[model samples]
Target: MNIAQLSGRGVEITDPLREYVDEKLSRLDRFHDQITSARVTLTVRDVKNAARRNRVEVQINVPNGIIRAEESNADMYAAIDKASDVLERQLRKFKTKFLKQRHEAQPQPEPGPAEQAAQLGEEDGEVQPEIVRQKRFELRPMTPQDAVFQMEALGHDFYVFKNMGTDSCGVVYRRKDGHYGLIEPK
Candidate 1:
């Protein structure tokens, strides 16, 4: 895989560090051969807190989706190792889910025309919401259960995915009560 090492504030991407990251990340090919590229970023935060200054972030782009992991430690190498380990676990989880879905055969009924009507109506107010930042990524299709797994794996509060069971887009989010909630189109 093509690995790019980026040096963030107060950090330098030396040849040795780049080689080490390349070596560690190359092992990920065994899990998924479709990994297109990997980006490793090194950052040194707050000089006063030396024990957690060295930070490493790894982003791996694969054919289906992207996997990202970050870790901070006293040493840069240690941070890289920790992030790599986390990334490996995520990859394994993703692979396992994909395999299970591929081998499973389930039948789902399609939504009727009346049942698939638009759920949200346009508001008459002139107010418009501001969107400061936007992110674009592949929306992998999976079940709500799988979306919850994906959200927790990424340590994110919510995850958006295409619901294969309904053949529609859905969002799985962590509720305030530590439970899961799923939103889908009517």
Candidate 2:
């Protein structure tokens, strides 16, 4: 597997720095060999408060999908280590889950498109209705001011609620530029 490390936000990027990152991320393949490549990015925050805001983000590419993990620390090396650790665990979890699902399906040998289509047509003779397997409980009657507070508390881009005074289903969402948008039933 190949590992590429890149530094952004005017940070110094050198071969030795990237080599260090590659060595840390390469350890993940010890647990899950299916990883094809990893891309790590380092960026320094422009905030004036503290150096802790510097961040490291890592992305691992697998056959099925990509996995991303990130962490911010006072030092760039610490941030990279923390993010790499999280990525390793996530890779193991995904690999185990995918193998278990494949084993349960007992899929047959690969076949040509014609044979596959015939099998699919036969299987489609039986129809099954889908059911809602999960239900999410969200929000409560509150003033718009309070609803906005709740939305930020949940760290979500949007929130749903019954406006206390209006007694109607409403939504408050965060915009890309840190603005709030309200949706009220007409």
Model 1: runs farther than 4 Å from truth?
A: 4-7, 47-52, 106-142, 164-169, 176-179
How does model 2 fare in lDDT? 0.67
lDDT of 1 by residue, 1-186 (tens): 678545565777788988888888888888877787887888887766445578888888765466889898888899888998999999998888768877887635334332222232455679887899999877887667777877877788888888887878887777767887677777
Listed in order, each prediction's TM-score against the native is 0.72, 0.54
Top TM-score hit: 1
Least accurate 10 contiguous residues by lDDT in model 2 = 111-120
Over the full model, what C-alpha lDDT does candidate 1 score relative to the true structure? 0.77
Give the winner by lDDT.
Answer: 1
Displacement of residue 113 (Cα, Å) in model 2 is 28
Q: Could you report the Cα RMSD, in angstroms, for every candidate shown? A: 5.5, 19.9
| Local lDDT at 32 for model 1 | 77
What lDDT is reached at residue 89 by model 2? 73
